[model samples]
Target: MDKRKKTSQMQERAMKTMPLGVNSNGRYWGKKVTPYFQRGKGAYVWDVDGNQYIDYRLAFGPVILGYAYDEVDEKVISAIRDGVTPGITSQLELEAAEKIVELCPATEKVRLVNGGSDATQHALRVARAYTGKEKIIKFEGGYHGSYDYVLFSTYAPPSTYGNSRSPITVPASSGIPSALGDLIITLPFNNLEILEATLKRCGNEVAAIITEPMLGNFGCADPLPGFMDGVRRLCDEYGIVWILDEVKTGFRIAKGGAQEKYGYQPDITTYAKALGNGYPVAAYGGKAKIMDIVGQGVTQGGTYAGNAVAAAAAKATLEIMSTQNVHGYIDAMGSRLQNGLRAIFKKAGIPCLLSSMPAIFSVSFGIESNLDAREWAKADASIYKKIAARAFEKGILIDEDPREPFCMSYSHTEKDIDDTLEIFDEIVRTL
Candidate 1:
């Protein structure tokens, strides 16, 4: 293993100035700090200490096309040379929005935003304004963003929450106002009976039901069959708006995201992460009837929203994906990795379940029974974390915490998958 002297020095300096020595909480691995990345290209990243690794984290699921892709970088450079941000909207903004409208089925009208958190917060405001209701329903183990409204019940301990049929709303972070918990109703994911029962009692007071089409917070779990259909049906029955939070699943799962993959249309949809590849760009839009109220009664504006550089990057990224069929390449690489890992686990006689789609995957150790987030808590996650640390020492990078998934981009090649699988085999044998 390469010594991380330089990385440790940087962390020591940063800890004196920055809170937790990182900008985002996810960057920390318990008491241990993650390595600082100096540069990235294709499917590889180099640390400040000059150690190279085959990356599967993919910048927390944003580098869909890969790191520093030439085509997108060229477009962004040209846009930056002309101007980064103008007092008024540029032509690039219109072009980027048009691309999103064409690809995503639910977005009849779209508004550019700064990040995933910005899109989710605005979507909730629009929903509340449209239906004139005060409360919202969110599922347990689903992460929309860092905002206070949706932070309830994400990554919470099983003891803090209620039973499987019913769930109690618990704050995921500190310093959030306690009263905000009263406005949110948390329910178990993939359970339609509990959702229907709760909605029947509080349907009139609920403004909307916001959910990630897939549970990205807890290891890339797919939705149970008919769960999404039930959500759509119940929202229509009541007057509650349906907000599909596609922050993690958008643009990576399919051309139109989870909505296209599952054949369910939402009243409001939030887009981010893979939308701009690695750039800072996000959007929230849906049926024209709902978004029309954005400027009229609800306000969603940001200075960095629709900046020239990000707009050009997003436009180029979407065009390349459309013409080149990037999803096809991603699927091939993902399949190779998944199949190879499964074979390794079986040969080593380890109890493992690989939960994922073609773009994202996660490894669960010693889980035999089908489980929701509650039952999953009984499993020893430290086992997976130990394996992840061992893999990192062997020139491979996956999230130490198993909750975050391993994301494959179009840029990942067959060679990278082969090398990763070889390392994975060696690592699992040690366990």
Candidate 2:
């Protein structure tokens, strides 16, 4: 009778030890609806109560191939058999780095890290070190990592965003020192004019202009035409290190990530997520001239940086991506799902805008365009929340927050797309 009975019990028990009964803040979807997953395989996951659902969250976009992919897992298992972390480098690390250099266009060299946050934090530091500057520029709603330097204007209330010309740098967290905000500048996404003006004013003091190719965190709001190229030109003109934070887009958008897809080269690029197909591996590197500063008095190292397990996972994942049609399959499936959803919304007479690529996109209701986080905040997400919650009840799983995009993987099938559409249609009609 009570499907979530076990889950509720687990939450109550977990809260005694862990804050909010979850390790990550995003995982706490309130005690009532938070799910405790048991295992995942392919495009589906089973909860502790043994309820099955077609998973679209994809562990926040890291499970690119699929959950428990045999090819990746087998490699990781074999590597673990040998050892995990020996606190030193191995041949596997070299192979993984080589594969990255071969595939990603912007990367001439790379330094492995533990996660997206590590990659981004180090990338910023490297930019500052290389340029001999103190200040950095980031776009509003562009989430780089959990570090203090980047924890501004992300998830902050739109009312606090101030004017578009001179936006307030609202800190995302409280513990961040107010003095840090002075060194950082936050601007709206998709607006190159503001970026150019800001850079012209303080370009010499700015070390890097770090941005996601698209707003990955706030409903995948895409760059306007020539936006990426404009950023490159301005960065070159101002002598600013362009750090493309592609933790979400890398290995998922294309074989060469955003650099290949958009044809705009960045001075430095940070990658995670699909790089290891859900394993804890990430990297930051770019032009040899910029990245070579890492060892020569510019410190960048980690205890588990090049662990064998993560390296093997990255090597296997990239090798499979190179040999197989991973992106092709994911694109096809994603397009099918996107088309089906568009048709459903059209038939329902509801205003909706889908932003970004087929593989990673967002469905925003009652919003014509999403150029930046401020515009995206105007979307009537309550309808989306209702649809997502009801769909979850009917064996579909998606993030309730509309800002988070729906991620597709190679494992999602045509049948899965059709089934999802059917369920969405049913729910939309009721709404």
Task: Give me the overall lDDT of model 1.
Answer: 0.87
Cα lDDT listed for each candidate: 0.87, 0.93
lDDT of 2 by residue, 1-431 (tens): 99888999999999999999999988888877999989999999999989999999998999999999999999999999998989878999999999999999889999899999999999999999999998999998999999898899998977798999999999999799999999999999989899999987999999999989889989899999999889999989988999999999999999789998878699999999999989999998899999988999998989999899889999999999999999999999999999999999999999999999988999999999999999999999899999999998999999988899899999999999999999999999999
Candidate 2 runs further than 4 Å off: none
| lDDT winner | 2
Clashes by residue pair, model 2: none
Question: Which pairs of residues have clashing backbones in candidate 1?
Answer: none
Candidate 2 overall lDDT versus native:
0.93
Clashes of 2: 0
lDDT of 1 by residue, 32-146 (tens): 3478889999888999998899999988899999899999999999999998889699999999999999999888999999999999899999999999998999887888889
Return the TM-score for candidate 2, rounded to 2 decimals.
0.99
